[model samples]
Target: MAAPLFLLAPPRSYTSLINAMLGQHPQAFGLPELCLFNVPLLKDLWIRASDEMSNEAKTRQGILRAVAEIYGGEQTAATVKMAQHWCAARQELSTGLVYQEIVERLHPLVAVEKSPSYTISLERMQAIRAAFPDARYLHLIRHPVGQCKSVMALNEGAFALYVNAIEFLEDRAIIEPQIAWHDLNINILNFLAEVPPELQMRVRGEDIMENPREHLAAICRWAGLRDDDEAVEDMMHPERSPFACFGPINALFGNDPNFLSGPTFRPHKVKFPSLTKPVPWRDDNQGLKPEVLALAHEFGYQ
Candidate 1:
């Protein structure tokens, strides 16, 4: 079985677009947010792990779509049902085993996936390393301001709240997305410390948006994949990916909804925001925390 490639990044960090783009490589298969590692066993996916978040069902959608497409050759209502049955058969197995089964099915084609949810905890990522020790990791990053702003824009910062990215004042608590951003990136960094240096690579999301072909080609070369004109061109069109759009209604989301609606990639320069400026989402007019600024500097962001 081919060692799969995993994209490690916080939510709203351009992971969806980049994962789809990398999957478009002829030698790679892009999968939806197979959030399998978020739990221990396949059955745990069905069980609600948190009362704070109500979207447990959404996390399973990726595997359903993946299984439906891989086994049935399409994602449809009937196929999703088939996927459910497939999971039912393996409910007793470890999530790593289940993920390996899917990767085995995609033999020769590198399985590429990014489940932002996985970044919420270091243990989930460690599970991936335990499963595929030879796996390649791409540490995708975005400017703190850009990522925090995008986080707040989506569902009123629900993900931040889910991760306990909160700040308590004298009276009330407010969602603090920058905390999630800093901590998730920290989780990724700590996990990568155990991975062999050669098996990991880091890329700025804004740099990729600025010049996809150049960055994609670099990634292809590092992954021992074809980086020729044809392969590079194919990677530029993330929209061409099967999972780029909404799957069957039953398994509707395996990715960010915004990306699902507009998977098309247009080449443009990404404008980064100032790190010292008062964040737009905070009414108190405070900027990023010192730790966030320090981490952002480590990621080459000003």
Candidate 2:
């Protein structure tokens, strides 16, 4: 069985689109956000990870969708039910072993997966490394301003709060999403430090959005896959991926709802917001913090 390739990024960082695009490759199988690593055991997924957000139900959706498509031969409601039974039968298994079963089932085709939730905790990421030591990782990044803005736009930065990314002032505390953005990237960087250079890569999300053909080809080459015109052509339609759409009612999302609503890849330049401007989500009319700006600058943003 081939080790899977994981795309690492915080939520709202274009992970869904990119994962589908890469999965659309003829030689690859793209998976829904199988948040397997979010918990150490299979049963933990059914337990609520936090009270800050109601994100627990969908945690199993990705894995169910994957199992239905890979084993049950379709993603219909009945098949999704079957996937649930499949999980129940193996409730005592380790998450790593269960994940490996999916990977092995899709042998000869590289599995491409992304679960932004995986970056919420270092232990979650470490779980992945332990499962597949040779797994390749693509540390996909977005501009801090753009990423943080998108995070706030989605459910009012619930993701940041879900991970306790709060900034405390002398009198009060505010949900500071940049803390999650910076800290998640740092988690990935620190984890990758021990991984062989050839097994890890970093790509700017905007770079891939604007000119995917070039970046996609480079990624395919790095993964030892075909980079011919036919391969590149296949990647242009992420909407064609099997897991690119909302699944049955029982398994509606293994990805961002905003993205699953429309998974198509339309090439265009993503406008970058000015770093010095006040963040729209802030009622205080305040700009980014100095620490946040410093981190953004390190990411090559002016």
Candidate 3:
């Protein structure tokens, strides 16, 4: 079995679109946000890991959609129901083992997946490495300003709150998405320190969006896959992937809802905001934290 390729990044970092595009490769299979490693046992997925968050049901949808598509050859209400049964049968198994089974089922075709939730904790990432030590990792990054703004735009920064990325001031605490952006990237960096250099890579989301063909080809070459025109052309149409669209009613989401609504890829230049500018989401006209700026510089952002 070909070891899977994992994309590591925080939420709203172009992961959904990029994962779908990579999956569109003929030799690769793009999976929705399996989020399997977020818990130890398969059954733990059904249990809310935190009282602060209540989106456990959505996280399980990816595995269900994947099982439905891979086993039943389609994603429908009936197949998703069957997937529920599949999970129940192996609820006691380690999530690592469960993920390996899925990878084995797609042998010879590289399994590509990314779940932003995985970066919330280093332990979840460690579990992934334990499961597939030989797996390749792509650490996808976005500009702090852009990423934090996008986070705040979605559900009023729910993800930041879920991760406890809050900043306490003189009298009150405010949702600070930049903290999440910085901390998550720090988590990814610390984790990647343990991975062999040859098995890992880093890329900016803006670079990919601005020049997908070039970046995608480079990624393909790194993974030992064909980087020919034909392969690159196929990757251009991420919407063609089966998981690109909404699944059955029983399992409606396994990825970012925005990506599912419009999986089409359009090449365009990405605008980068000034790191020192007062953030739009802030009421106090505060810019990025010093640590956040330091990390942004490390990521090659001005």
Candidate 4:
């Protein structure tokens, strides 16, 4: 298998678009959020065993979509069944083992993926490393203010609560999403510290979206993949990726359902917010807390 490339970021950080874009590269196969590490057994992905919150279903969409494309050459109910059988064949294998098998099948082309859920646990990432010690990682970051606002906007901070993402569940009972935003980013940074510099690259998501051609070329160069104009143009068409459109009914997505429904890339410059000012999401006049500011600076925001 080619060296696995992971896109690391907290949820709602534009990881979906970025991952799709990178996968669209001619020499890369961008897989959906396989989310295999969430479980030890591959069968657990198909059995909806819990009445409570379990994201196991997240595994199906990616696999189904991949099967539809790689094996069946189309995403239809028949192809979805084919995907089921493919997964069933690997039911006894560990998630990483199954994933590596897929990667191996796509050999000579790098496999690109981003499972936002992976950032929830340091152990999940460790499991990825344990499987493929030579895997490469892209530590993608967004400004805390932007990341927090996006997270809260989606399901009222449900993402935050799900990950127990907050750094400090404070006595003040303030809904400080910056706490989760800062800490999860810190989790990625701290975990990545042990990885060799050659195996990792950090890119600001805002930069990629705003100046995709330039940034994509930089990333391609870093990954040691082709950085020619044709390759860059192909990466720009992330919407062309099989998983970019509607997924099979059995597995709609490991990405944003909305994104799947209408995945298109448009160029626009992202405005960086001021760290010293009150954010629009917060009702009070209070600005970003000192700790949040520090974290923003760490990500190279002033």
Candidate 5:
């Protein structure tokens, strides 16, 4: 079995675009956010959760679309139904096994994937290492201010609420976004410590967006894939990924819903926000939390 590549980050990072681009590499197979780790059982994915928000449901869309395209050769309702059965047949297997099966099916091409939810817990990441001890891990980082802003923009920060993405929960009960940024990133940092440096790497999302061709070539090199002009050309068309657009109705998402609506990848410069400034989300121009600032410095923001 091929050693898989996993992109780890909190949600709303430029993970979708980066993962798609890397997947489009001639020697790689980018996959949708399978989100398999979120649940222990495959049926749990289809089981209606109490949250009722349907966010988890979006995770299935990628697999459905990929199955439709890779196996069924068309993304139609019927193909999506076939994808469901495909998942059903492997309902009892571990997520890592299922992913390996998919990668093997695409033989010789490296499987590239990013599932932000994997960062929610360290144990989940450990499970990945245990599954593919030789697997390569990419610890993709985004500035807290930028990441939190993007998170808040999506569904009015419903994801933060969903993940209980709170940082400083003092006895007085003041909820702070800065703390959320600091702590969540800290979670990622600490978890990454256990991963061997040889199998792991890090990249700033902003850098990739600002200088895609260069940074993408760097990423390709890191992943042991070809970084020639042809590979560079293929990476430029992330929009060409099968999951770049809306998934078939039966399996509508394994990616950002916003991306599903408009998943075009255009190269553009990204501005890094000043950490010293007050965040725009709060009614008041509240500055970042002290802890958040400390964490930002650890991530080399200072």
Candidate 6:
């Protein structure tokens, strides 16, 4: 079985675009978020991680869509139904085994994936390494301000709230996405510490957005894939990916909605906001926390 390349990052870190871009490589297979590691068993995907708004349901949609596309060779209502049955058939199997089966099916094609939820707990990440001892990891980072802003912009930082990244003020607990941003990155850093240096790499999401061709070529070289113009050009057209656009209603969201709405890749510079400035996400207009700034700097951000 081909060991896969897992992109590790928190949500809203350009994971969707980057994953799609890398997946479009001629020698690679960009899969929608499998999120398989979030659970110990294949059946657990249907179970909530907690009483709060865990992303298991939405995450299952992505896995189902991936199964539908990879197995059914199509993602239609009927295929999604088939995917449900597909998952049902393996409900008793270990999630790691199911994941390996997918990797086996896509052997020789680098399976590029990122499930931000994987960073929520070290156990999820550990399961991945245990499954693929030779797996490669990519630690993708985004500036704290930009990442937190994007997180808060979506449903008032519900993901942070779901992950218990909250701060208690005098009276109420408000979502603090900066906590999630910092802590998730830390989780990735800690996990990567145990991985062999040659088996793991890091990239800045902003740099990739600015110079996708060069950065992508670098990634291709590192992953032992083709770095020639032919493979590189294929990666540039993320919109060409099967999962780039919205799928049928039954499996519409195996990816980000913003990405699904406009899956095309535009090579433009991302004007990152200042780190110390008042963050737009907070009504109090607080700047980044010291911990957030420290991690951002460690990631080569200002």
User: Cα lDDT of model 1 overall?
Assistant: 0.94
1-302: candidate 4 lDDT, tens digit per residue: 68889998988788989999999999998888788876777887777745223455565677767866777888887888888889888898898888888888889899999988787778888888888899999999998888888888877887787766543333434466777777778778877987889999999999998899999999999898999999999998889988887766666666776678777898788888888889776666777778779878877998
TM-score of each: 0.98, 0.95, 0.97, 0.91, 0.91, 0.96
Clashes (backbone N, CA, C under 3 Å), per candidate, total 0, 0, 0, 0, 3, 0
Better of 3 and 6 by lDDT: 3
Q: Rank the candidates by lDDT, best first.
A: 1, 3, 2, 6, 4, 5
lDDT of 5 by residue, 172-258 (tens): 343344555655566677877887887788888888888888988988787788999999989988889888887666776778877
Clashing pairs in 3: none
Candidate 1 residue 21 Cα shift, in angstroms, is: 0.3
Among all windows of 10 consecutive residues in model 6, the one with the lowest summed lDDT is: 47-56
Tens digit per residue, CA lDDT, model 6, 33-141: 8888988899898866443234557778888888889999988999999999999999999999999999999988989999999999888899999999999998999
What C-alpha lDDT values do all the predictions have? 0.94, 0.89, 0.94, 0.82, 0.78, 0.88
Model 1 TM-score on a 0 to 1 scale: 0.98
Compose the digit string of candidate 2's lDDT tens values, residues 156-213.
8889899898988778999999889889988888888878999998999999999999
Error of 6 at 61 (Å): 1.1
What is the model-wide C-alpha lDDT for candidate 6? 0.88
Question: What is residue 197's positional error in candidate 4, in angstroms?
Answer: 0.4
For model 4, name the residue pairs that clash: none
Better of 1 and 6 by TM-score: 1
Residue pairs of candidate 1 with colliding backbone atoms: none
Q: lDDT tens string, model 1, 240-292?
A: 99999998778889899999999999989998899999999988889999999
Candidate 2 similarity to native, TM-score: 0.95
Give per-residue lDDT, candidate 2, residue 117.
84
Scored by lDDT, model 2 comes in at: 0.89
Worst 10 residues of 5 by lDDT: 167-176
